[model samples]
Target: MDMTIDAIDARVVPPVALAYTKALTLPHLASAVRPRFLVLQPNGSLNQANSSDFQHGLESILEQATDGVIVDLLWVGSLDAYGIAALVAGIQRATALGKQMLFQALDAKSRLALEIEWAQQQESSVGAWKHTFSSNLEAFLDNFTHG
Candidate 1:
């Protein structure tokens, strides 16, 4: 099936809320075809400070999603030790259900740091997770749309 991903920039509360609203409004966004996957880009906003709230939002979306519809998440933010633990916990939960969850850092330095931390805390298999570091949104969109 052809994949359609709605790339949402959840940088603020309103946009985060709007992302969820837009997912629910999928029927109106396109004609005939419903989205095969929902890829969430919780950039900068998803952090240890707001882990609980972020998890709640994700859970809500998961609960509402149709069966077989994949929820692919990329969480990016400045994470403290505790926040990183929380993020890992969330990733584990998603993995248990066979969901596609990625923990990405927006910067190269942060990405390297996260990779080391993830390797140390490797609760799951090495291939079970993935990471990405890029600031270019348009390039991502073009590749995503074409591929």
Candidate 2:
């Protein structure tokens, strides 16, 4: 996995800037390529105040991503109804665009909040589709790499 988040042009496309530990690497052409994680991490707090910015950035990331996107929720201090709405919108857009959106590293509080929000979105007893993982590496290994 790539330890440095360098070389990506910030002008052309803004990188997902955040402090992180694990990155996901998948095989490319039968070789282990460096993990290029494009995760959307909330800066400061996630609430009604910054929902629009978050939503715009997320949509842009999803649009530019070739494989998909990884949303890192570990640093989010809090989540409100507006934040939930923005997140749902981003996921819905990704789905409509046929892009995979993986959410990872959710703390207990964040996980519960998301679970509640997702439950509300579901019309049936069957759960709605949630692409979540313990870590970005786990998501890549499970979804992309062949054992």
Give the CA lDDT, 0 to 100, for residue 22 in model 2.
Answer: 26
Model 2, 20-81: lDDT tens digits are: 32232211321232224355555456788777767776776565555566776766677787
User: Using alpha carbons, what is the TM-score of model 1?
Assistant: 0.42
Cα-based lDDT for every prediction: 0.46, 0.60
1-147, model 1: which lDDT tens digit per residue? 111235333333332222444223333333223232345445444455666655554554443333212333334435555445555555555656665555433466555655666667673565545465565976898789999
Whole-model lDDT, model 2: 0.60
- Model 2 ranges with Cα > 4 A deviation: 1-37, 124-147
User: Alpha carbon lDDT of residue 79, candidate 2?
Assistant: 74
Give the TM-score of each candidate: 0.42, 0.55
The lowest-lDDT stretch of 10 consecutive residues in candidate 2 is 1-10
